[model samples]
Target: MNKKGQLIVVSGPSGVGKGTVLKEYLASRDQIAYSVSATTRSPRPGEEHGVHYFFLSREEFEQTVQSGGMLEYASYNNNYYGTPKKPVEEQRAKGNDVVLEIEVQGALQVKKACPDALLIFIAPPSFEELASRLTGRQTEDSKTVENRLNIARKELLCAKEYDYIIVNDTVELAVQRLAQVISANRYSIKNMKEFLDEVNKHA
Candidate 1:
């Protein structure tokens, strides 16, 4: 069997620089397909559709769930976040890595659906630093910031379940490590044993 591309699952706290790391990682690589999520939340002032997210209506989101169109999905703060199964499967079929930037709940759901997927956790240097970064952004009000911090505290518990943890102290270093993970997963011997056996037969 041919070696298939990997499904990379990434989750982190709100202020852990996950977005920056992903941006730099994408900029440096050509074969990766960043999974665009289907979300019911309205885009922010400058956010674009199909880039930041695939913005959808509540009814459309429900139809996706009902039709088994999503690999995984979850509701948070009254908004729906989901990973569309089609694009990801298509990328994998074409031997291209598909990276999913998901929350812990959705990450677990993907793991259940695709046990071969690689799970990575991106984190800040420390909880205090994460909080500082969140506050400095000025994107949300005090209440919203507090809510995210609370969720971050809960999300920290998921670290143990992840396959690898990358600290986002610097975007360059984080992107480099993420690339390494993608490369290494492609060479996983568990999936290459059959090819080796065939080579031995030829020898």
Candidate 2:
């Protein structure tokens, strides 16, 4: 029988390079599924439905949330974002670790729903550095950047709520740390039940 996979939920402030680190981590691993969230927001350039996110109309998104299709969800910037329940369960059943990159609100909700879920919070090396990164993006206006910074401050406060905190000083280092966490969990006694049972039968 296949060992059940882990459910990992990652939360971090915007522009902290969570995406860069996670992208590299996924590139270097196998049997790790990234949970694509559903959103009511319009897709950005180069973003595809079912790839970047499961884009849905506002009505459809609300209907799913009401009918229990979402595992966790929250509204941000006037748009709804959420993890779909079925895909995550399917990936876990197939012995593939599932990673959910979401906001703090959604992450907390997930923790309540799945007590075994590993919650990791990625943080910037410093608030100043975080500000620099946000402004450096140049994608959004200064006003938007400032808004993100304000939200980030609140998000950082919630870092203490996570099971682990990873300061993303560098993409390479962050990815390495993430790998270490997953490796440690893979060998944890709870995850090693199949091996333990086999040894018990032999004894």
Candidate 3:
């Protein structure tokens, strides 16, 4: 029988380099599956439906949430974002670890829905560094950057709720730590039921 895959949820405040870390991690790990979230917001340039996000109408998104198709969801900037339950389950059924890169609220929701889910929080090396990174992006206006920093403060407070906390001082180091977490989980007692059963059978 194929070993069940793990549901690993990665979350962090904006500008903490979570995306860069996960991008490198996914590129290095072929066996891992990246969970694409569904959103009611319009796709940005170079983004594709079903690839970057499963873009849906507000009504469609709400209906899916109502029907329990979403494993976890949240409203941000007046748009809805959520993880679709089917794809995650499908990937796990094939023995592929599924990674969910989401916000803190959605991560908390996942924890409640799937108690075994591994939650990891990424954090910046320092508050000053985080502020610098947010400004460095130059993607958002100053006001927006300030807003994100405020939100980051709150998100940081929830770091204690995660199973692991990774400090994103460097992309390489963060990816290494994230990889170690996944590797360690593979050998966890909860994931080794089949192996234990086999050993008992021979004994």
Candidate 4:
């Protein structure tokens, strides 16, 4: 039998730099595919629909959620964000490991939906550093930034629930850790079951 791909869930607080780490890590991983999520939030300056995110309206996003098209979803900052079921399954079925860079809520939901999925949390070196990064971005207003910081505190409490937690002290180091985690998981007992079974039979 052909080897099946694994579902990787990379989650963290808002300003943890998970996206930057993932981007660098995935650059050298040809067999891994990044799962694009659908969101009700408006695109940032350089973001494009179907590229950065699906960029759906509230009604469209709710319709997908209601129809069970979303594998997992959560309301964050008054906007809906979710993983589309089809694309992820399709990529995994094709033997391409799929990674979902999502928030804590959606990551938990995915864990329930796909028990075999690998849950990795990215954490900031310190809460103060996280605050600095958020403020440095200048993307949102002061009120919004405070709201995110509040949410980040709560999200940090759930990091222990994840299978692995990597601190984003430096983007390069975080990328290295992420790659190592994925490589190790690929050969884990659970992920290698089919291959192991075949080997046992041959033996």
Give candidate 2's error at residue 19 in angstroms: 0.8
What Cα-based lDDT does every candidate model obtain? 0.88, 0.92, 0.91, 0.92
lDDT of 3 by residue, 1-203 (tens): 22888999999988899989999989967778999999998887889999999999999999999999999999875689899999999999888999999988999999998977899999999999999998997888998898888888989999999999999999999999999998897787767777888888999
Sorted by lDDT (best first), the order is 4, 2, 3, 1
Clashing pairs in 2: none
Question: What is candidate 4's lDDT per residue for 1-203, written digit by digit as tens?
Answer: 43778899999989889989999998877888999999999899999999999999999998998998999999998998999999999999999999999889999999898988999999999999999999999999999999999999999999998999999999999998888898898888788788788999989
- State how far residue 105 of model 4 sits from its true place (Å): 0.6
TM-score comparison, 1 vs 3, better candidate: 1
Superposed on all Cα atoms, model 3 deviates from the true structure by an RMSD in Å of 1.8
Per-residue C-alpha lDDT of model 2 across residues 1-203, encoded as one tens digit per residue = 22889999998999999989999999978999999999998887889999999999999999999999999999876789999999999999998999999999999999899977889999999999999999997888998898889989999999999989999999999999999998887787767778889988989
Give model 1's TM-score versus the native structure.
0.93
Query: What is the Cα-based lDDT of residue 67 in candidate 4?
Result: 95
Candidate 4 Cα errors over 4 Å, as ranges: 201-203
- Each prediction's RMSD over C-alphas, in Å, is 1.8, 2.0, 1.8, 1.3
lDDT of 1 at 192: 70
Q: What lDDT tens digits, residue by residue, belong to model 1 across residues 143-171?
A: 98999999898889988889899999888
Q: Select the stronger candidate by lDDT from 1 and 2.
A: 2
